[model samples]
Target chain A: MNASTLWIFLPILTGALLLFLRNQRWVAFVAGGLSFLLALTAWLLPIETTLALGSYAFKLSSTFEILGRRLILTTNEQPILTLIYGAAAFWFIASPSVDKAHRLAPLGLVQVGVLVAALAVEPFLYAALLIEVAVLLTTPLLLSGRDKPGRGLLRFITFQTLAMPFILFTGWLLRGIEADPGASALIRQAAILLATGFVFLLAVFPFHTWIPLLSEETSPYLTGFVLWVFPTSALLFATGFVDRYAWIRTAPQLPQILSTVGALMVAGGGLMAAFQNNLGRIMGYAVILETGFSLLTLSLLKTQGIDLFFLLFVPRLLALALWALCLDILRQNAASLSLQDVRGLARPWPFASVGLIFAHLSMAGLPALAGFPIRLAILEDLATVSLSVAAWAFIGSVGLLAAAVRTIAILVAAPAELAWEARESWPQRLFIILGGLALFGLGAFPQWVLPLLNRLPAIFEHLGG
Target chain B: MLLNWLAGVLILMAGIGLFVSRDWRWNLGAMALQYLAAFWLVHASWPLAASAVKLITGWMACAALGMTLASARTEPGKEHGWRDGGFFRLLAAVLAGLVAFILATRLSAWLGIAPPIAWGSLTLMAVGLLLIGITTQPLRVILGLLTLLAGFEITYAAIESSELVTAAQSVITLGLALTGAYLLVAAKEETPQ
Candidate 1:
């Protein structure tokens, strides 16, 4: 069997099959197990080679062709596959802990399958259509039973659909550019259209209105999964673009533009996140900040930007997952996530409190937390590029730090008569404690995830030095 | 060549219908007709069999959306009238058409596509975006999406006659219809405070 069939098609069919099975917990374990297994297979197997399994001998080819297009999963892509599936497994396995998370179990698997196909598809133009399909698939996961589709969902669909045409138009132009790179006007137009497409997909400033709106309208837990998966895949898709096109990767001004955009997201997301009253929206802002950080990392493409970009996944996933878990737990007890509603919550929800605090601190890149060292390195490198960009990055961290402090103050703002108690269920407490410690574990020992992130650069041939 | 002009004119008319109508039934009718116009233009470049996919898929989506709205308890929104700024809506459509007409010449030459096809795609794209920009209601927004894609498809069909791209675009068309139905029924629940 080919890698595409085994990883992409099989999981989709399996997900369709799992839809009939109504046991949420059972489905979570099964899907999570399969995800882990797929990840492990990627880690262990060498593509485009024949291996003998005692008595059976067969080849596991890397390319699967259909409709005259190829989905190629080579040895170079092993790390990315492992990263995607490993992270999927983590999200799935941990999903059983949060309310409204059951929706993610089966549909989430299908979504991941489509996203993986988007990443693997050749003639990268097709990736735009695949990504749009993947975005539509996520609508159900975001909606609760009988709930109206929110404004966020509509704008989300609109912006995403709008991006496809631009990218497709770019693809049409790229053929012209490839035939004659001297077509300067075509090249300029293509670059602008391509960047606009990615800007929409990335939810850069003007387009980010949907993030907080969706967060406010839906469960934080569900929003977290979409926030993490779609943008990460989009960024990877963009890196693939940079890798393939000689003119794009060699463009002199691209880095400065990326840096400026990254700085904008950092400052805007961070400063805005600090002033928000709704806890869920704060999570949304953190996502925006994280995306900004990613763009900043990517701007360093001239150096080790790609490597730094990959390192972000491990800490970001851990932080968002932990943060989302705590918020979901709090959501069960409080009427709403507004400051007035969650006031003095820590007295009864100590473990959730700790988990939430650690997560917030880590995202703010506080020293001794998981995000610290990497944030420090990126900022140092960014400063060498331009101190103004570095200053904006620093201001962003401080803004997030301010938000973290404000959140702590509210959680501990207990009435005098209120007393501390561990009111969280055992499962909630266990996961939080473990998740919290994992953040610390990765922080103290960067080696735990750095090696995996280090290998991700192999997937791109020319872009990341 | 005359048939292409008639098809382009029909496209702009259907777009005008979509631009001002709030009633789901009328909107669907306009959309189905828009697809027919698109099919006629595309058939000039692609095989009849390939061109028919756009027609069939577009009608199927309209039928699906129509069934949902017929069964759906609420109106698509308040019916459009002078109070809803009908004159302004017509003005917008006219402006959009004018812009499309202006661009069609350059696009036809640069992309080496037919003038009729370029005009058809560009006009639909402009009107579709106008529809999306004006509406927040789910069904109308989705209609706008379908309209935009139809516009893209007309030109795209002429440029790249790949069956794979055609199928993928058709699936996207259907996916938008299904999702639109989903959002319509989903309106039963109120927004959380």
Candidate 2:
């Protein structure tokens, strides 16, 4: 197989082989080395043409086909795929330093499965299936000694499963329209189901109760994987449908509806996040609010909007990865995720606390950091469409910013209490330094990053649909 | 015309029997009757030879009926009386019936056995969405999911059938159902009665 195809599946194949290697140290070293090389190659190599497995191939660098109907991956997909696999590499590198969790091999394999789902043409059902399998994979990781299952895994599985029929059926409805050419009735039906599935999967508003609940129970690493990879993959998958189907793209008021839903999620998630004292739950809210902003960008429906959508991934992946790393550190060091427990942690674990703050700022879309340029681009696009949409988009950013600021304030002002006296290992300290540097690097010179994102729209302009 | 009338009668009788009947055994009987009615309706439009797998799936509904009976507690006198049980059973049966009816109508249209109507697939989906949205009880939710699945299956018949998506969905449905049933049993055990 060619490099592009090989790059995509190599990590997956290595992960599978790791299961029977009978050498943990060798597996960790070799796996980390191989994943780093593959990610480097995927980043450096020129994009390939269609790479097919059987009857189906990843047709567009952005799209694929499922069954008989097309499941388009948009041109916006490449940067996101790069970011995802890149972060997966980072997580793998850090895995050795983190706690000894079982089933490392399968965990990496599941990560590959999620990446494949992201690249899958019909992400509708296959993505959800991958998510369910991911959840099952985590059961062994999350539930070690406990005989009774926690509500967290169940809630996660239920919510994920609940979204399945919505997606599958929506796809079915859209296919039905193609059967009897030029049926407006089927179009509207497909649109509604599509929107409903989006809401269900995104955990928009009322359907989002599972986020904080599942957040509380799952580990920082797995929780971060669920929040970032799965949901972001879903967003990428949804982008395919909007990009490919001109009917969806051309819908008169659909963009407005999407923006409105996104704005609501931002406002609602922010308010809830502000009330939550738990760090993990706050991270969940922060991610949700950011998701709102992503949707808002998608709603603008312009080249800039597409660019902003692609741009959003960079900061989010870096910030969430750093944040999850910090959480993993804090959980091991402090055994608590409360703001109160983390107070005065700056004195002892200055590197981690600073990393957390920077990550939070990046997530908040603060100026100069990773999230700012993208959010700014989205607002500019929105302004071009309508002043009111721009205002709504701004309103969404404010909530995210407010939540981040609140997290920062709490991290600083809480009464000093020594919860645990733990020293950071050399590896943890190195990760914190690296993470901080990356955040500062991205924040200081977003121009360098903007060009990378700039490539996304060009790709989309040519072949996204 | 006679076949349509027979299908309609069987469905209606099964629906009423499911809701009004007091005995648990009668619930199984009504569920079986409803499946039979649905099978006949599915058969009337798509010939059995062409749709053997689906026909066998219809037969497997009998196994689902048996499984449901096994799942229900045998307590003759519980807080939820025959009335409550009957209402739920009937509600599930009716939702399934509505799904079957929509499928039959669409299939008939597809086969040129009936005049094509506007929004045929749309109407079925709308009904399924309504059922799923309104239900909270596990049994009802499963029924709602089945309704939603049926709507999609009929829609798929009009489109390309992917053994890929179908096989994937079948495995998922089986696993989900087993998980749901396990959860129900666990919930029953956990609740302080």
Instruction: Say which candidate scores most in DockQ.
Output: 1
- Per-residue CA lDDT of candidate 1, range A1-465, in tens? 899998899888877777788787888888899999999998888888889999999888988988988998888888888988898888888788774536887888898999889888888788999999988887888885578788988998998888898888899899999999999998999999999999899899899888888877777778888988988988888888888998998899988988999999999999998999988888888889999999999899888657888888889999998898898888889998998899999999998988999999999999888998899999999988889999998898888889889999999999999998999888788888888888898889888886677778899987544
Q: How many angstroms is residue A264 displaced in model 1 relative to the true structure, after the best TM-score fit?
A: 0.6
Cα displacement (angstroms), candidate 2, residue B177, comes to: 5.6
Q: Native contact fraction of candidate 1?
A: 0.63
Model 2: fraction of the reference interface contacts it also forms: 0.13
> Which 10 successive residues of model 2 chain A have the least lDDT summed?
A456-465
**RMSD to native for every prediction?**
2.0, 6.5
lDDT of 1 by residue, B1-193 (tens): 8899899999999999888776677788999999999999999999999999999999999988888777765455566577668889888998898899999999899888889889999999999999999878788789999999999999888778766788889999999998887787787442210
C-alpha positional error of residue A411 in candidate 2 after TM-score superposition, expressed in Å: 3.9
Taking the candidates in order, what DockQ does each have? 0.73, 0.17
